[model samples]
Target: MSLFDIKRTKFNSSEVISDFSHFKRRLLDEVYETKDELQLVCSSTGIFEQFIEILEGLFLHIRQTQTSAPKIRLLFPKSKKVNSFLEKTNISDLPSVEIQYIHEDEFQYFIAGVDKSISLFSEPRRNFERGFNDSFFNVISLKDSVIWHNSAIFESLWKQSILENKVKDLSRELNRNNVSNHNFVRILAHELKNPIQPILGFSDMIQNNKRLDSDQKNELLKIISRNARKLDIMTNNILDYARMENNIFNLNLEIFDIVQVIEELLGDYTLQVNKKNIKLDLDTLSKKIMIKADKIRIIEVIDNLLSNSIKFTERGQIVISVRETDQYIVVKIADTGCGIDEKNHKKLFSKFYTTDKLGTGLGLYISRIIIEKHLGRIEGRTNTDGIGSSFTIKLPVK
Candidate 1:
């Protein structure tokens, strides 16, 4: 038969001489000798072990040749057996092996080819009497126009396999986030109720107690106000979290001098910082670095970060630094406070999660949402000396 013509070879029990050795001697060397590319589609792991010798020969040739080997790509049906086979073989570490998985229904036959010159499609035998050492598969070779047609078919399937995997990954991530958010909602409901109950009872008693002295009434009013402020903060955080989850949160963009905003915030927080005997300072790369963003939301982000720093700090300093890059506006809030545990860093921005019992836990979470809405990100790290934490916010300057 001509090299480009079609040929069929069967290796069932009836064809004893045309078994594994005969097939390997006739076809394996020619396929591997091709310099351009190799492609494979295997429907089952049953035939995988049978190809070890052939693959070993191919890899040995490439290594000794000291030249780039033909690009080799393989597509297989998704299965535990196939995954195990790949892991055991370390197929990914091989020089030219690119592996992908397709749905079982999308592929049902075995195919292999080397370059445009030679290719084979096989149908597996179902009624084989022997196992392991048996050769009960049928293969047919095609070349020229027919080989090109088969390559196109494999390429389409390869693209589909990639798209399928990406979609599955996205779906799994969404499901995990949904479960996490659902659990936090329950915790948030409990947190909100904890302070509300006390506020309600205090207000009721204050209104009904006709003979209470002025001093007694003032103490109850102060308690009510304290809890009321807590409730208001929690309520606002819940709304912000909800808006972020639903993808409805938007930045009210405006151009403003960011350095000025930081300076003003530090001035306003001076009294609070003084109450704890903490030194508050600001360092600026420029006196007036400007950016376009939601001014109010940015202030909220800065306020949340600074509050956390001051709350944990008893007798140290809090510093706010402003700097700008060619493409980003960078702000760092660092404090010599009771530093966060290294292990809890990953959980810092999670809703209703806090390391301290006194904190509402929603501050960092809502701050992250607001910064992200402005096309920015917030990241925190504990100081290496183990005495403080620093948070950095980077906003794009487009």
Candidate 2:
């Protein structure tokens, strides 16, 4: 009699097949006849290895031959071997295939079903070293009740798998954030101390050195002033961060000329630019482009961008440009400095992310929040010429 001929076995009942090859052949034939959906559950990587090739072939055949391929779901126990198999074969990348991992203790048998018409179940011997064929009990069921029962079990397991995976992901993220916050606290302490030490040193020299000339005393006062300003900026950032977290931050909006604001801001940086011997250039499409925004916050964003450009550019030029479209004003700050790595572009504005040892990593983050609050957007990227970096801000013109 034929190996799979139901007439030779039994009708509408379960048939036990002891031979592994015979069972595999029958399973493949059933899958080939599947027109709607396929569901599979493998208890271990050893069992999954025996049937992955057949599953891949079915995926290819359906993609090439059918207008709409059926959805296939495969559930496997979580194990290092299963992960390795998936990575090596790239089966997970195939279309219409969804894979999930269940806890090993929960998965005990191998099951495969085509639509709701037929299913194959086998409890392989736990001693995988002896091979699956040695103690396999294969059941092929054609009765509606039997197939329906198996399908119900698959649905329950699929939902459980999703919950388990999500919990694991959340746990990992929490651990990562804990580590990042620890590093941030250490860095913040160093950044805060940097400005304080300079201020204290310059003030003490001015107080104790009675023989110093007017020019020397004036220069020391200037040094103290600059360090005080740095402290002010850092303190503002910390307060603003707290306000944002508590949802109490507010904007004082007003109509003003954006070009004039930028010009005045650049004047404040004249001393720093000259000290570093870097050329600062400004280009504007018009003398005045009016916009409605929070003036202080807008200036804060521009200041942060200009400060970053100056900090990174050692010798080359820094350029600030402003132009207007029918609906918006565009501001760009470009510099010839050390360009940012492409991989880090997305993380530039993320909280607690920084590239410099002295940075609090809050400037760009706060800048993004302020711009967005004003219904504007900001972006940073490497300059087109690849010499440095550029930051662009776009705001609605009222």
Candidate 3:
């Protein structure tokens, strides 16, 4: 017998249908007949070709509605064929068709409804072919409780599916970031070791060489002191970075001479600048440009900028200048060194990013944090002539 004829013999004299093809046809017919709304749920809609036919039928049904059209929603389990089905149907062109995807495991049957007059359910199947009919299928009464229960079930599954996809995306992003950080930490450890090896060797020599002249001993001692200071700075940068990340680093704000801080830091680098024959100069609008901030952190910010300039410039000049506005203090550190590329200007302060292979890349990052903590911002731009870069800092006066 034909599918409709078989459904007639299988079902009572009601709206219920047993044949799969008859059930699908009647569901589409109801969508065409519905004056209120239509909803559908299924594990999968079989092949791409079958899904396209259903999409076409839905569009046609909407078109045939001469009066007010019914709202339509389709919920189906996500499958490999979803993208292809959407591609062929051009679902974006049909705004009336609302669809959402759930995990394939979450939906194990077929259910469809139209208004409050009809509801249908069927055993899950890979396709709609009648030859493979192996499970129960029938339309049920469209009572208030049955309709409410099915609607609630679909809503819960839809929300859960969206959450699952978001969590998966976040987990993937975190994994990638963790791997990048792990590699950077390994490099930072190597940088810390470089200064220590020289410090240890020089200390051993100074201790053993008893016949050395006073000048020779003093020179060795200075070398030891420089290396030790370098190691100390590196260690402190990393510790500060950790403390800042954990939200435990607090500022000790005080009023201090901004010029004095710059001059003192410059004096510390005098020996190194003389060694390289580079000129380090300072300029200020006043002898005392007082500002309220963490004195030590401000010193750190300027020290990092000066160090960067010295590292890149072989025989050029570095100028540090301080000036004040009505409500802000501005410090400008200009260099005559190899300038950074324009494209890299924005990423210069990112953590663990450096142009030099041996650098730990934490200096600029730490400087930015300290400046921001003081209600200030730090920025660097290549000089107009392209010979070097200038780092500018603006701190609030209040």
Q: In terms of TM-score, which candidate is strongest?
A: 3
Tell me how far the alpha carbon of residue 66 in candidate 2 is from the true structure, in angstroms, after superposition.
87
Taking all chains together, each candidate's TM-score versus the true structure is 0.45, 0.53, 0.54
For residues 169-261, write the lDDT of model 1, one tens digit per residue.
434544777644444444544565566565656655554455778788676656655555455555555556556767888778899999999
List, residue by residue over 1-398, the lDDT tens digit for candidate 3: 11122233323324555565776676666667777777777665452233356657876666566356667777766665776666665654565667777656433466667785666665533334554344334565454434443453444444334434443443354366573454555565566556656555554455444577778866765765676566656656766766776689999989989898888889788878999999999988799888889998888888889989998888789999888998889999888899889999989999777998777677999999999988899999998998998999999988
How do all the candidates rank in terms of TM-score, highest first? 3, 2, 1
Q: What does the lDDT read for residue 32 in candidate 3?
A: 72
Q: What lDDT score goes with residue 51 in model 1?
A: 64
Alpha-carbon runs more than 4 Å astray in model 2? 1-180, 210-216
RMSD of 3: 25.4
Better of 1 and 3 by TM-score: 3
What value of lDDT does candidate 3 attain over all alpha carbons? 0.69
Runs in model 3 lying further than 4 Å from the true structure:
1-177
How would you encode candidate 2's per-residue C-alpha lDDT over 1-398 as one tens digit per residue?
Answer: 01122223343567778887788888888887877889998866666767776766766676676557677898987788778767865768767779988767433467888898887876664556676665666778885544654565565456446533443443354366564454655565566556656555665455445587879977766665675566566666776776776689999989999899999889778878999999999999789988889988898889889999999999989999999998779999999999899999999999867899767688999999998987889999999989999999998876
Clashing pairs in 3: none
